[model samples]
Target: MSLNRIASVRAVLGISLTLVLATFFFSPSYSMESRDNSSSPVAGLRVEIKQTSTSPITITSTVVNDNDHTVTFLVYNSPLDTAAPSIGLLTITPDGASEPLDLPKLQIQRQWPPSPESLIQLQPGASQTADIVLKDFIASKIAGKASVALKGRWDMVWNKQKDDVTPEMIEQAQLQAEPDVFSGSFASESVEISPA
Candidate 1:
């Protein structure tokens, strides 16, 4: 082949290789649906509450990953639940009220970026339990039968070191302000809260 023809062939091969590498390495990652697409994280997950004790109610949530792929969750135990700073949301609907009342916000014990230990990973068919105290969750206004619900909003964050997180991700999560990944909202069976 002539010098020019050989040079042209090499240029085309280089370009083709570059495109293949880019498509393979720089392409978007194929991530399984982190959520069940519905407002609930998993179809089988459930929340149970015990209100026998008036001083401190006990709340337990069982999370089951029913999807075919593995999933990870960031379970934050706010100051109300634990002494650490983590992301969480809890609400209660009063017996006679139509709307559920949001849990009172406690002081953020630990500020971001969160430590690696906060990440909870679950394989398919795996389950995890989160036990929280319902002390301040149930208000005196919720007289009679009350319904409890918990919403977990953080799930989209990549499971990696804080350095791997970008400013855009932080802004998207509203990390300092609100939760970005909304796993799902779980409701517990109604329970009676006797009048004080």
Candidate 2:
């Protein structure tokens, strides 16, 4: 082919390839918002639990927010309420057993939508941790066990709607606007622990 003809052919192929790539990458299925609304506040919230110490039988649990927006929610394993039994933080299952250890669950009596000030808000890409001392449940129960697996789950604690919100509730919270509750349960990978 002539030099001019070859150059025109190359330009056409380059333009076609660019359009195809842009269509593929920018499509709704590949967009960040499509994967469970990844741009939403609740997207990619992860929970992780690790055995910190054997003496006190402590477990360090962390909740990481991977989304771009802030998330507001509650955690039973709050630092202030460390002594209280968690609502649905960690579940302990022995290596060979089918049933999980009966860890006490804390029951709260509150209004439908929890107090705005009562909720915990985490910024985008930030993480919150609760170091739980499982001495009461683990030390005695899993004593001398070769290894025990632990799974941590964070459950959405509220069922309130936008209508249930009050004006004063918004003013009291750290979030200036009406906060969308980060709904859904996030579970961590099962971590194996060896107790002495």
- Ten consecutive residues with minimal summed lDDT in candidate 1? 78-87
Per-residue lDDT tens digits of candidate 2, residues 68-183?
65665554333313443355455677678878777767676644445655555667677887766765554577745433333333333222333444545543442542233334
- Candidate 1 per-residue lDDT, tens place, 19-126, comes to 998877655541223222333334444444444455555555556566555555454542123321123366667777878764456666644655556555666677
- Top TM-score hit: 2
Residue 72 CA displacement from its true place in model 1, Å: 2.0
TM-score of each prediction: 0.49, 0.55
Best-performing candidate as measured by lDDT:
2
Q: What TM-score number comes out for model 1? A: 0.49
| Candidate 2 weakest lDDT stretch, 10 residues | 150-159
